[model samples]
Target: MGQKTALGSLLKRIGNSNQGKVVPGWGATPVMAFVGAMLIIFLLIMLNIYNQSVLLQGFSVDWNGV
Candidate 1:
């Protein structure tokens, strides 16, 4: 079909154009460090909240109320 031929030619042109391109962006190291720092902060906050909850609730369970 004509549509199929047009689509194939469009794809071929795009492939040829992008054959040796770098597509630049940030390298991995700094982005990874940022993500790692955020994860540590999140874990610390969660641990603090869990400790507070344990202190207030004293490990008691009321399963039947569920």
Candidate 2:
């Protein structure tokens, strides 16, 4: 119940704030852009690795081996 009340107050405070304020030391836009760029890079690298694995060396399963 206490946790619920605290969460409700926090939500109400956030709702009341129309003027956006970024946390000190780091602006939101730059952090978001950096995170987005990193995500894209990671996805590209994963795709390349997957392509190499599937296209260059095919996967096969032998029932006898299993």
Relative to the true structure, how large is the alpha-carbon lDDT of every model?
0.74, 0.72
What tens digits encode model 2's per-residue C-alpha lDDT throughout 1-66?
Answer: 345588888988889786676567765888899999999999987776656643544543435655
Candidate 1 error regions (>4 Å): 1-26, 53-66
Error of 2 at 38 (Å): 0.3
**lDDT score of residue 43 within candidate 1:** 94
Residues 4-48 of candidate 1 have per-residue lDDT tens digits of 688888989988986877767765878899999999999987776
Q: What lDDT score goes with residue 29 in model 2?
A: 80
Report the alpha-carbon TM-score of model 1 versus the true structure.
0.41
The residue ranges of model 2 lying beyond 4 angstroms of the native Cα positions read 1-14, 17-26, 53-66
Weakest lDDT window of 10 consecutive positions for candidate 2? 53-62
Q: Could you give me the TM-score of model 2 versus the true structure? A: 0.45
